[model samples]
Target: MSATPSWQAADGCVHTGPLLQSVNGFDVVACEACGFSHTLPLPTPQELEHIYSHEYYTQEKPLYIERYLEDKAWWDEVYAERYERLEAELPAGRRRLLDIGSGPGLFLAAGRERGWNVMGVEPSERASSYSREVLKLDVRSMFLNEETAPTLGQFDVVNLGEVLEHLPDPAGMLRLVHGLLAPGGMLVALVPNDFNPFQRVLNESMGVAPWWVAPPHHLNYFDTDTLPRLVQRCGFEVRHVETTFPIDLFLLMGHNYIGNDTLGRQAHAMRKTLEMNLRAGGETGRALKSRLHRAFAGLGLGREVLAFARKIDDSPSPA
Candidate 1:
């Protein structure tokens, strides 16, 4: 692992304030010059690999994928809408895409299905193999660093889906992504909106970590406000912004087990959680909840958000 960055907070992430007791384990500090409310005590490269290989992500096949693939027509319509929006502003045809941390190669699958030439960079051997063998796509098993980046030409579109916050240094990673873009290339990034309402309520009540809080996996958090700054720091200019993925199952999972006994026990926990969630709110309730969620999301409460930016000109900076 690289030496612990000089910018890391000496006292670590936890600190004291009047309103908030302890802000979990994150090391938050305002930059002396820019006053960015960002996390410090960022993970080292070694820490990053440990967190990613931990039990949290070892399990494959999240329930959402199963549901998404089973309902092909529905997912098609949804992706079409998304594809139109996410790709509309950028130039079409002759577009080569690179998806970092392409687990299970879902986006690559979509790209291939759409006839887009896509390449993936993943560190996990198992996931990379699955992406290649199962999805029949090309994938490279390597971390994104100076040594690992391919000398291949710049890409036209880069996708960083649920990937930036997982890095030890988001600023550095964004700079690297910027270097790999062709002229006028656009970057499509999606991270969990750290300031979402459900997250606020969860942290206020239960001290339990949100699923997105998997230690070491998520070392940084970004919202709409801070995200653009980070992007500009890495040398890309913000072109478009959209908060998406309003139908989040993670919050539903939490609302299911909240205030609930027999949650951590064996025997029917998953089944019971599903039953309780479906019962407290059947699909009808979930549908209405999604509608309400969209309304709140328009007000900035979406669980996930997708931001688009372009490399206006070359202006890469140092760490």
Candidate 2:
């Protein structure tokens, strides 16, 4: 591991609030100026490279790939809603998509099936190989940075699903994505909802720690308010923002399924079952679920925060 660097905010300030808590040996603090929470002693690029390349899927969570494949039906329903929104927002015939951190090409496969030209950039060799050999998709076995962006060309849609929270410098990543998008193109990002008020209440009620705040893996934390603001600050117009179902509701209602492996798995299975059943109910069920999702998002209590932004034709270059 590289030497631990001094604490700094996205704007380059060195001052920060007192330690919020320590997770996995890294100190967590809120930026005094921006009010965003992040892990102190940020992991170096080399460490992150090694983690994502060698140990991410295999060791970090051994069953991640298998479980991801097992939940395809549920994930497909989520992907379909995102793609439908993208199609409705953009004019017909605009189909090029670039999925950053595309794991096993699920989203890329979903896009391809919907008549879009899809490409992926993933750092995991195992994942890249699977995407190519199994799915026969176009994927680059590397990370997305300024150097690699030119090689991929511009894209009509840039998808960053579940990616922003892992970065040490998320603002820089967003600016880079801004450059890759074509004029009037859209960007869709999904990030975990951390340090949320509802989750805090649930944690207090259950007398348990905040299980979602993992360090090294999840370096940045953002809620519904801050996420869209961050995107707009990066030179994109915020178009839409929504949230996934808040599983914390079960905890608030006295379920307390966090530590019990069986209960946790059952909760996840229940979510998948509900989604699959609704999707099987045809258009009416789909529409009803969509409205329900919107309502949940409006309440600002969801497991994940989903936001969509567009690069305006006359927007200035990202700073």
Which has the greatest TM-score? 2
Candidate 1 residue lDDT tens string, 171-284: 667778878888888888888777456666666665555544443455555666667677767778887665654333344465444334244222233433443353357668
**lDDT, model 2, position 209:** 91
Q: Write the per-residue lDDT of candidate 2 for residues 99-208, one digit (tens) a residue.
A: 99998999999999989999999998888899999999999999998898889998999999989999987888988888888888999999997777778786676566
TM-score of each: 0.71, 0.92
Clashes of each: 2, 0
**Whole-model lDDT for model 2 versus the true structure?**
0.84
Worst 10 residues of 2 by lDDT: 1-10
What does the lDDT read for residue 312 in candidate 1? 71
| Root-mean-square deviation of every model | 7.4, 3.4
